[model samples]
Target: MHLNDLSSCSSFTRRSFLRSASAVLAVGPILTEAHFARAAALDAAVPEFSMKGIHLDANENPLGPSEAARKAIADIIPNGGRYAPPLYFDLMKLYAEQMGVPVDHVQVYDGSSAPLHFTVLSFTSPTRSFVCANPTYEAGQRAAEIAKAPIHAVSLAKDYSHDVRVMAKADPNAGLIYICNPNNPTGTITSKEDIDWLVANKPASAVILVDEAYIHLSDATSAIDHVKAGKDVVILRTFSKIYGMAGIRCGFAIGRPDLLKKLMDYGNSPMPITGMIAAQASLMDSDLVTARKKLIADTRNDAFAWLRANNYSFIPSQTNCFMIDVKRPGPQIRNLMAQDGVHIGRSWPIWPNYVRVTVGLPSEMQAFKTSFKKAMDTPAAAFNEMPPLRSRRDGVVV
Candidate 1:
C-alpha cells in the first residue's frame, strides 16, 4: 500500500509482481534515456517552459540524437543496470583514436560544462585570474566566481571574435584563458592562427582553455591538435551541441594526460553508461557529422535571410545560434515572445538589447518570425518578466 510498507512485506502477490515487473520494463528507461532531450530537471519548477512553447533560446539541435544513437540507446536499455569499466575505457579509446592520441589524453564527462568548471577550480584562484571574452560561455566565468578569482572579460574584436592578444594582456598572472570557438550567442570564430599566437604569447604558467562545443557546426579546425603538440591548452568538446545530446550529456576534456589530471583532482566518477553508449554510437556513424552540419547551416542561413529582409540587424554566425538586436529591452522582447508561446533566450548584460536565438526547425523558425514581429510591436506588454536564471540544459543560462 505504501513505499515503506512494500519494503516490509515478504509476500509476493500479482499486484506486487506486476508493479515490480512494470518498474523494470517501463520506469527504468523513463528514469534514464527516455527524456534525453527534455529539460525535465529544470522544468519541474517552471512547468510552463515544458509546454508547447517554441524554444529558440538555447543552441540545441532540433534534430536530436542520430538514428544510430537512438538505436544504441534502445539496445543498451536492458544493460542499464550494469556499469562496465572496460566499455567506458573503450569509449575513451575510441575518442583518443579519433584524436590520434593515446587513450590517456582524453577524459570524458557528462558534458563539457563539468570539466569546464572543474578546470577553473583546478587551476584558477585569487592570485591567478580567469581571462575570457566578455560574451563568451558563462560556465567558466561562474566557476571563476566560486574560486574567487578575478575575471578579466576582454571585449570581442572588430570581427566579433575573441581578441586573443587583448585577453592575453588582460591579466599577466592569469591562470586560465577561455576561448569558445565559433563563440556562443554570436557563433563567430577566432582563427587557428590567432589561437596559436595566444598559445605562444600567453604567460608560461597559464593554461589556455579552448571550448570547441560548437566546432563541429563550423568549418574550423579543433585546437586539440595544439594539445597533441604538447601545448598548455585544455580543449572542451561536447555532443550536446551538433550531436543533439544537450539533455543526454556527453562531452570530453582533451589535453595531455598531465593536464587532464588537474581536472580529475576536483572529482572523477564513472559516466552514465547510457551517455557513453550513445556517444559511441554517434561517433561510429561516419555520416552523422557532415549531414547535421549541412542541416544547421541551411536553417541558420534561412533565419539570416529573414532577418535581412525584415531590416533586423544580426551578426554572421558559424554555429547553430546567433544574436539579434531587438531594439527594445531584451527581457521585454523575450517575455512578449513567450506570451506568444515562443520561449526565446535572454540577452547578456553587456548587450542589453540583443537576444540569442538558436536555429530551430524550418517550421519553428517561421513561427518565430511571426511571433517576433508581433512581440516587437506590443508596446503595452510587460517588460519585467525575465526567464529563469538556471536550467538543466546547457546554454539555458547566460
Candidate 2:
C-alpha cells in the first residue's frame, strides 16, 4: 500500500533468454502425442467446478494487481472506446526502458502464453525439434507437437534443476530449447551457470527461450542480461505473476528485434489498452515487487515448514508454486482436496505422485494445510499407472 512497502529491486531486462515461434506451425507435428489423463482433464464434458472453493489450480498470484495498476485501469477505461494505438507504443517503450534495452527489443502480448505458443511455432518445424525438461510446463511441448516437430522431453536432474548439459545434447538439430526458470508445476530453479552453458553449447542457429514468469519470487537473477548482450535468447515476462495481473493479461516477449519480428509474421490483434496502462503503472511502482515477494515468500516458507514437520515431502521452490509428494496419485489427492472445498493443481505425467500447490494468502494456506491433512489421513484407493484411455479421443487432437 505504501511506496515504502516494497523490497529493493532493479529493472529486470533480458541480457539473454531464449524464444519460441508460432502455434499453428507447431500443431500438425504433434497431433498424435497424447496423454490419456491429460486428455480427459481437457474434455468439454469434464465437470466445471464454478471455483466455489479455495482455487489454487493455476499458478495465479492471490495478491492480484497492485493499487497503482487498478487506478491506471480505471483512469484509462473512458479512453478505451478509441483505438488508442499509441498505448501499445508507450507500453513497449516503458518495458524497454525498464529493461535498459531498446524498444525494438521488446514486444507485448495479451499474455505471455501467446508468445510462449508462438515462439515454438515460429522457430520449430518438422525437421527441427523442440526440447524441454520432462516435468516442465508442457505448453511449449504442445506447440512443438502442433508444429509436427519432434519433442525431446529431458528429465530434470536429481536436485530438480534442468539437466542443462543433457538438455544441450537432447537434439543436435533442436530449433528451440525452452527453460521455464522456477519451472511451472514444480517451481524449482535452473541455475545461471547451467543456462550460461546451454547458451554457449547450444546449436548456433537454435534459440533459447526462457520463461521468467515467476522469477521475482526467487533469489535467482534475471538472464535478460544475455539478451542485452545479443544472445539468441527470448525471455517471456508476464504481469500475471508478481503484478497480480492474470485477469488483466499483459505479458512481454523480450529479445533482439529480429527474433521478435518472426512472431509478428504469424499475425496478432491489437492489445487491451487497460492492460497496457496497468502494466506501465505496475512497472513504475518500484516497491511493488519487493512487497509482493515478501508476502509470497513468508506464506510459501511457512507452508513448506509445516509440510516438513508433518514428514510430507515437497520439492524446494523459489516461486509461488511447489509440488508436494502426497505418497499417492497426485490426481487422487487433488480430487479429494477439491471435495473438501479446497482445490489444488494437476500432476505432470512424469511425477504422477506429486501434486502442485500455489502459494495463497495466509488464511487460504491454513485452509490448504487443514484440508491436505484430512485428504492424506483417509485411505486412498490404489492408483493405476496407465489410466483408461479417454473415450473421446477427438478432443485430445488439439
Q: Per-residue lDDT of 1-398 in model 2, one digit per residue for the tens? A: 12232222122212111122222332332221123233434432235546477877677887788999999999988988975655666677678889999877888887887788778998999999999998987778877877889999999999898899898888889999999897886788888988998999998779999999899988877889889999999999999889998888789999987888787665454678889889989999999999999989999999999999999999989889899988776766766676677777766778877888889989999999999998889754433433432334443431
User: Candidate 2: which stretches are off by over 4 Å?
Assistant: 1-46, 381-398
Measured by TM-score, the strongest candidate is 2
Off by over 4 Å in 1: 1-47, 380-398
What C-alpha lDDT, on a 0 to 100 scale, does residue 22 get in candidate 2? 27
TM-score of each: 0.85, 0.87
lDDT accuracy of residue 356 in candidate 2: 80
lDDT of 1 at 162: 96
